[model samples]
Target chain A: MQVELQLFATLRKYAPDQPLDKGLVMNVEPPLTVSILLEKAGVPLDKVKIIMVNNRHAGFDQELAAGDRVAAFPPVAGG
Target chain B: MTERYARQLNLPHWTPETQQHLAAARVLVVGAGGLGSAVLPYLVAAGIGLTGIVEDDRVDLTNLQRQVLYDTQDIGVPKAEAASRRLAALNPDVEIRSHRTRLEPGNAAAILAGYDLVVDCTDNSAARELLNRTCLNLEKPWIHAAVSEYFGQVTTLLPGGPCWQCLSGTGAPADPPPAGILGPVAGLIGSVQATEALKQLTGTGRLLVERLLVWDALLPGWAEFSYRRNPDCWACGRG
Candidate 1:
C-alpha cells in the first residue's frame, strides 16, 4: 500500500530512514499500524505528541489503509 | 466604526456590527510572553473593550528577544503590569487589566470568569490542561497557539469541540520542555492567534474549530489537519 507521511516541525529532519521532509509518498507492506509505520519511516515515536491519520486524531495502534495520510508532530511547547 | 477601526471595518464582511462586537468583547490573555505580546497589541488596537492579562512573571533581559510588549527598562517589572501600561499607551479606548498571578487551579476559573473569551499564550501543558477543563466547564471559546524552533500551530477551541486533552491524548498534564525558538516563529504564530481571536469574536469568517493549522518556516507553508471530539476524553467528554 502507498501512504503519504508528513513529519512536522523538527520531525522534518528525519533522514536516511524516511529520506524526505514534509510530505513523502512511499510504498510500504500491508498490515501497518501508526507506531510501526513511524518506525519504518525513521520518525522516533517519542518526538511525536499528536498523531493524525488522514487529519483526524488517531491512536498509534490504528490500522493504515491505502493512500492514508499519516501526520505526526512534536508538542511545540514554547511561548 | 470610527477612524481608529476604519481600515479593518472596510474589510470584507466587516461592518459596524462587527466593530460593535469587538468593542463589547472582553478577552483574557494568559501569559504575557511572546504570544501575549503579539495577541494583546492586535486585539487592543482593533478594540476589544476589556482585555485582561494574567501573568505573574517579571520581565527579564532574555525575554526581549520576542516579547515585544516589554523593553530594556521593563526587565524587572511584572509582565502583566508592564504590558498593561504599554497597551494603554497604544490605545486608551481599550481597558487593560492585570491579574498579576499565574494560572493555577485555584485562580484559573476566577480569572477566566470575568472574560468572554480566552487566548492561551501559556508555554506548558499543565496550564493548557487547566484551561481546557475550565473553559469547557464555563462554555467559553478559546484560541490555543504554541511555538518552538522554526514552527508553530494554532487552533480555536469552542464549547463542545475537540479540546487540548483530546489532541494531547494524555489525561495527566506535564510541564513544557524547554526548546530553542526564533523570535519570528513566535511572532508569526501569535499573529495568527490574534487573527483567530478577532475572527471568532465577531462571527465573521471560518474558524479553525476542528482544524489544527501548522506553520513550518523551513518549508514556508501552511498545512491543516483535523481532529474530532473524543467521546471518552477526560476534559470535554463525559469521562
Candidate 2:
C-alpha cells in the first residue's frame, strides 16, 4: 500500500535530497499502523507531537488503508 | 442582517443566522504572540462580539520573526495592550478587552467565566495545562495551537472531546529539540485557529474536534490524528 508520510523538524534529514524539509515517503506493506510506519521509516515515535490520518485524527494503532496521507509533527518546543 | 457581514457573507455555507450567532459570541485568547497575533484580527474582523486578550509579556525584537501584531514603535509595550489597540483599530464594532497578567489557576476560572470559547496560544506546557484544566472544569471549548520551528499542530476541544493532557499525559515530555518556525508557518496555523473559532462561533461547519491537525510548512501538508478522551485523564476523565 502507498501511505504518504511526513516528518517534522530534524527528522527531515532522513530524506536529504527531497526538495523540501518533509520527511521521506515510502510504500509499506498492507495494514500499516502509525507506530509501525514510523518504525519502518526509522522515525522515533516518541518525538512525535501527534499524527494525522487524512484530515481526521488517528491514534497509533489506527490502521492505514490504501491512499492514507500521514503527516507527523514532532513536539514543538519553540515559542 | 447579512449585509452587515456582506464580505464574508459570500463565503461558502455561512448564513445570516450564523453571522448573528457570531455577533453574539464571546471568546478569550491567551497570549498575544504568534498564534494570538494571527488568531485575534480574524476573529475580530469576523465580528465575534467580545474578544479578550490576556498576556503579561512585552514585545521584544526577537518576536518580530512571527508576532505580526506589533511594529517597531510598539516594542517595550505590554503584549495584551498592544494587541488590544490594534485589534480595536481593526474592528471598532467588536469589543476588545485586555488583561495584562499571567494566567494562573487562582484567577483562571474568574477570567474565563463569561466567554463562550477560548483559544490557547500560550507557549509552555504548564500554562497550557492550566488553561486546559480551567476550560475542562468550565466546559468551555478552546482551540490549542503550538509551534516549533517549521512544524505546528492544532486541535479543537468541545466539552467531552480529548484534551491536551489526554495527548501529552501527566508527565511532561523533556523539552523538545530546538525548533523555530518560518513566519508564514505561524501565520498559517494561527489562521486555521481563527477559522476554527469562526466555525465554532457561527455553527456553520464541523470543527477539528477530536482530531489533531499537524502541519509542516516545509512539506506544506497536513496530518490528522484521532484521539479519544482518556478514561483516566486527571483533567477531563469520566467524572
Candidate 3:
C-alpha cells in the first residue's frame, strides 16, 4: 500500500528529508500503522506525541489502509 | 437595539439582527491564558449574551506578555475570576461566569452542557481531549485553536462530523510539547477563534470543520488540510 506520511513540530525533521509541506510517500507492508511506519522510517518513538491517519485519531495499533495519509506531530509548546 | 449595535450591526455581512443572535448566544472559553485573553474580550464586546470561563490556574509572573486580562497585582490570583472581572467590565450587558476548576473527564460534559458554542484555548493535551469528548457527546459546535512560537492552528468541530479526538487520537502523546507560547502567536490564533465563533453563531461564512487550518508566521503563509472521521476513533468513532 502507498501511504503518505506527515510530521509536525520536532517530528517534522523526519519527513524523509523533504520540505515540511511536501509529505513523504512510502510503500510499506499491509496492516501498517503510524507507529509501525515511524519505526520503519527510523523515527524514535519517544519523540512523537500523537498520531493521526487521514486526520482521524488512531492508536499505535490502528491499521493503515491503502492510500492512508498519516500525519504525526510532536507535543508542541505554545498557548 | 440597532442603535446599540450600530457599529458591527452595520457590517455588510453582519447586521443588527445577526448581532441579536450573538447577544442571545452562550459561549464557553476553556482557558484564560494567552488564547483566552485574546478571544474573550472580543466575544464580550461583540454582544455574546453569556460567557463561561473555565480555568484552574492562577496568574503567574511569566504570563504577563500574553494574558492581557490580568494585571501585575492580579498575579497568583485565580485566572477565571480575574478574567471574568475584566470581561464583565468590557461589556456590562453580557453575563460572565467564572469556573475556576480544571477541565477533567468527570466534569467536562456538565460544564459545557448549557453553552451554544465552545472556544478551546487550553494549552494541554489532557484538557484538549476532555473538551473534544465532551463536545462530541453533547453534539455542540466547538472552535479549537492552538499556537506556538510562530505557528498556529484552528478547526471547528461540529456534531456528526470528525471531532478533535477523531482527528488526532485519544490520550496525550507520550511526549507532548510543553505549553511554550509567544504572546502574539496566541493572540492571532485566539482572535481567529473568536472570529469563527461569531461566524458560527451568526450563520455567516464557512467554517473550518474537518479541516485543519495551519499558519506559519515564520513562513508567512496559511494552509488547510482536509480530514475525516475515523470509524474506530475511541471518542467520536461510531463505537
Candidate 4:
C-alpha cells in the first residue's frame, strides 16, 4: 500500500528531503498504523501533537488504507 | 447607523441590517496575547455590542512584537485592562469589558455565559481544551486559532460539531519551547479569526466550521482540511 505523508512545522525536519508543500509517497505493508508509519518515515512520535488521516483527526492506532493522505503537525503552543 | 460604519455598510454584502447585527453581537476573546491583539481590534472596530477580553497575564517587555494591543509604557499592566482601554479609544460606541483572569475549568462556564460566541486566542493546549468543553456544553460557537513560527491554524467549532478534541484527542501535548515567530504571522491568523467571527455573527459568508484552515507563510498559501465530529469524542460525542 502507498500513502501520502505530509509533515508540518518542526515535523518537517523528519523529512528533510521532501518539499514543504508537497508530501512524500510511502510504500508500506498492509494494515499500517499511524505510529508505525511515523516511525518508518523517521518522525519521532513524541513530537507529533496532531494527526490527520485523510484529513480527519486520527489516533496513533489508526489504520491507513492505500493512497490515504496523512498529516502530522508538531505542537505549536506559541501565541 | 453612524458614519463610523458607513464604509462597511457600503459594502455590497453588508447593509444597515448587518451593522445592527454586529452591534447586537457579544463576543468573548479569551486571550490578550498576540492573537488577541489582532482579534480584539477588528471586533471592536466592527462595532460588536459587547466585547469581553479575558487575560490574567501582565504585559511583558517581550510581548510588543506581536501583541499589538499594548504599548511600550504598558509593561506590567494587565492585558485585559490595557486592551479594553485601547479598544474603547478605538470605538466608544462598542462596550468593552475586561476579565482580568485566566479561563480555568473552575470559572470557564460563568465567564463564558451570556456571550454569543468565543474566540480562543490562548497559546496553550489546556486553555484551548477548557474553552472547547465549555463552549460545547453551552452550545455556543467558538473560533480557535494558534500561531508559531510562520504557520497558523484556524477553525470554527460549532456546538455539536467537530471540536479540538476531535483533532488532537483528549490529552494535551506538553508545551513546546518558546519558538520564534514573525509578528505578521500572528496578525494574519488573528485577522482571519476576526473575519470568521464576523461572518458567524452577521451571517455574511460560509463559516470555517468542520474545516481546519492552515496558513503557511513559507508557502504563502492556505491548505484547508475537513474533519468530522468523532462519535467517541469526549468533548462533543454522543458517548
Tens-digit per-residue lDDT, A3-34, candidate 4 = 98988877777888877667888999987999
iRMSD (Å) of candidate 4? 1.9
Sort candidate 4 into its docking category: medium
Top lDDT prediction, candidate number = 4
Task: Please estimate how well model 3 matches the true structure, expressed as its whole-model Cα lDDT.
Answer: 0.80
For each candidate, the alpha-carbon lDDT, in order, equals 0.86, 0.80, 0.80, 0.88
Off by over 4 Å in 4: A29-31, B170-172
Model 1 local distance difference test score: 0.86
TM-score of chain B of each: 0.96, 0.94, 0.94, 0.96
User: Please, what are the lDDT tens digits per residue for candidate 1 over residues B57-103?
Assistant: 99999999999989999989999889999999999988999898899
Q: For model 4, how does the per-residue alpha-carbon lDDT over B21-50 read when each residue is reduced to its tens digit?
A: 999999999998889899999999999999
Error of 1 at B132 (Å): 0.3
Q: What is the lDDT for A28 in model 2?
A: 90
Q: What are the clashing pairs of model 3?
A: A49-B173, A57-B166, A57-B169, A75-B177, A77-B180, A78-B180
At residue A1, give the lDDT of candidate 4. Answer: 89
- Taking the tens digit of each residue's C-alpha lDDT, what string does model 2 give over B1-239? 45557988888887777787888898999988888889999999889989998899999998887999999888998988888889888888879988889999888999999799999888887888898999889999999988877778888988878888787662335666546668877888899999999888877688998877777766667766777778877777754
The candidate, 2 or 4, that scores higher on DockQ is 4
What are the per-candidate TM-scores when only chain A is compared?
0.87, 0.81, 0.85, 0.95
Provide TM-scores for the models: 0.93, 0.82, 0.82, 0.94
lDDT of 3 by residue, B86-118 (tens): 888888888999988998887889889989999
